[model samples]
Target: MFRHVKSNLLLFLLFFSGRIVHAQSRAVSLAEALQFAQQNQLTVHNKQYNVQVNEARLRQEKAARYPEISGAFDMRYNQQLPTVILPGEFRNLPAQNIPVVFGTKYAATAALEGNYAVFDPERKYNTGKAKLQENISRNELLVAQTDLALEVRKAYYACLLNHKKIKLTLGNLGRSETFLRNTQTLFQNGQVQPVDVDRAQFDVQSQQAELQKATLNLNQNLLSLKYQMGFPLDSAIVLTDTLLLSGERQAVFLPDELKVEARPEYRNLQLQQEQENLLLTRNRHNALPTLRLYGYYGSQAFREKFNFTNTTEKWYPVSYFGAELNWLLFQGFLRRAQVQESKIALKIRHNELLIFERDYVFQTYSKLLAMQTEQQNVHVREANVQLAEKILNVTRIRFENSLVQSQEVTDAANDLLEAQTSYLNALYDFILARLEYERIQGK
Candidate 1:
């Protein structure tokens, strides 16, 4: 008995602490949560990083157009002097062979060399491709943001709907408890059978069970909302938004005004198509001849015994500038294969763009229809809830006047709860559908 009492006390303390935490929860609106998610969500941050990386790549490509200058130095010693054979007739010694080295035993040289592309057909296209890639990355970041906003909306709506359900459940629970007390009073006055009192008690227990279930569901939905918002789940939060529809009807867009091109995803695909076309052009231009201007200014020293510091030693300076042209007449058909591959890829991307446009048109129309249907369902459910309330009030009055059975009263209460739950579900669906429609419109 003592152990049971101690466990009950512990449960009471936990329940009381939970209630206090709930009371102190910070209130947040849907817009505030979405803004917070945009600032702190890991996915959005990663997408932003990708955009930065592509921007840097664009700078690198542009910088490549400048001339390149480099300095080089080298020192070398000949282990065995290089020898060249000369005819013996030069020395007037017939039938004799003599070997002579043409270069110094030790040598050192330093030079600064510069190169500039005089004519490069592919460079212009490469810069263009880099700029296009940066634009694509920016659009991709926008796409990620849109996706994250949709996820936040879904989770937020679910949490708000769960909160509304909990409120309605609590109201029903209160009414059930009151009904149970009235039934017990009638039994004490010998006005109703013991079975009727037992039935009333069971109805109250059922309502308690429902309240417990709704509370658990609400807690889980809150955790989901927190995860979507990138917020800490251990912290307490209260949603300030209510699950209800505004009296005004939402504006619906016609098919012609859908403007699929406004969507980031579609724009990204178009950019990709441009990239593929650019690749094909670049590959085709690869066969063109490239001309480059190169120049070097330097000095060299040649010593018989590595005596470069000797006053007698001298340094020879050299300078020259020249233009070189290189034409890759053939690369074993490698360029041919690249050109063919690029053509195929460009075609593939074009096909994807067409398919995407068609699918987006269908999807947007479908969502619009769903939003309209759900809006009508919300109105219908709202009316049913009102009717259920009236029916419940009448049933209770009938029970008090001894004109109806206890089971009828319980059934009426159940009907009202179901009607209220259905209404909340309808409202949630309508809101989600509307959000999706807006998303498809690129809002």
Candidate 2:
């Protein structure tokens, strides 16, 4: 009953799990898939935009350090108010002989202003912070690139494995059907029991069920790869690198220092910690006064010629050069509180940096162990598959000569199926292990 239910479930999955269209397909390469995923992934696209934004911001920050020049022209007209005499005993309106005059007044001014900060403790530190921020964004982009490549490789491998599984399942189904036909023929001749024919029929149905499941799984994996590559859902593609199961992507053992240096995520964290330290220093240095040397050279002009400077030049001259020092004497206690906050933040970042380094070390070691184990399994599983194939060949001859029972031949076939499946699984695991290890190593 359990077997029958399982078989029904597989049939349902085959009918509904994925869409099917029997059509010729084109092949996709690993490199092409990875490139397409990087270009099409929404997250990667966003990160690329963020890098541009950060670059613009850094340029603005750097520009702020240079001198700025601006010009302003102003004109104002005002009306004067008239003075009135008070009506008092000492100064009566009849005795008063005073004049009240109301007139308009105008003032026009034009000047160019320029300023440069010769020395500012904060600006100097802020420049470095902007650079570090740029580095952070760049590292974030690299991290996105690495993650997308890893995902593409995994998905590509999945589709390839699923295709193999479908083929394997279909082959098993054909063999089972053939076996059922042979058993029926033997039963008619009274050479085998009817029970053997029934069992052969059951095996054929079971293999057919598994084949359906394999077909469903293969199509689903293909769809997933298409989604990753930003291809149309109805589009058909065949993987070209089926025979290229695994390739060497790493050295036997890279130097620990090299991994630490090349890992983008690690460098990003290190930059963050440095930024935190710089911020803390800025907070502590808040007590230091900022000094600036500013100078401006401008010309003034009036609607009518003015005698302020009778120079032959058509414009009036107004130039000034000065130095100013500013110290934050008091803010309603804002500076002190900021310094305390920054110190606390720096402490938190320090702890986080420690944790990151520890985890990175652990991850590197774990990957190394996994890669070694997978390499060993590849060799062992390959040998097991060869032995199973040889055994199946010998059993087939014995069964044809009437020296072995049909059940014995069926058992050998089942063993061969298991061995082949086990070898394929081992190969797949080896690939997965290598990918995982590389991912951790940030290769």
Per-residue lDDT of candidate 2, residues 1-443 (tens digit): 35445555765665454334324555578888887788888888899898888888888888988987788876655455456554444555575555555432544567778788876778868788888888888889899899878877877888877777776676666666666666677778888787777777777786776676777777788888888777677978767777343444223544244365577877887897898788878877888887777777766544333343545636557889888888988778887888788888878877877787788788877777877777677668778867876776677567656688767767877887787688778767877887877777778
Candidate 2 local distance difference test against the native: 0.73
lDDT of 1 by residue, 97-209 (tens): 88887888899888999999978978879799889988988898999889989998888888877767767776776676677778878888887888988877777667667
Runs with alpha carbons beyond 4 Å of true place in candidate 2: 1-26, 77-107, 243-258, 294-321, 330-358, 389-410
Clashing residue pairs in candidate 1 are none
Q: Name the candidate that leads on lDDT.
A: 1
lDDT accuracy of residue 178 in candidate 1 = 72
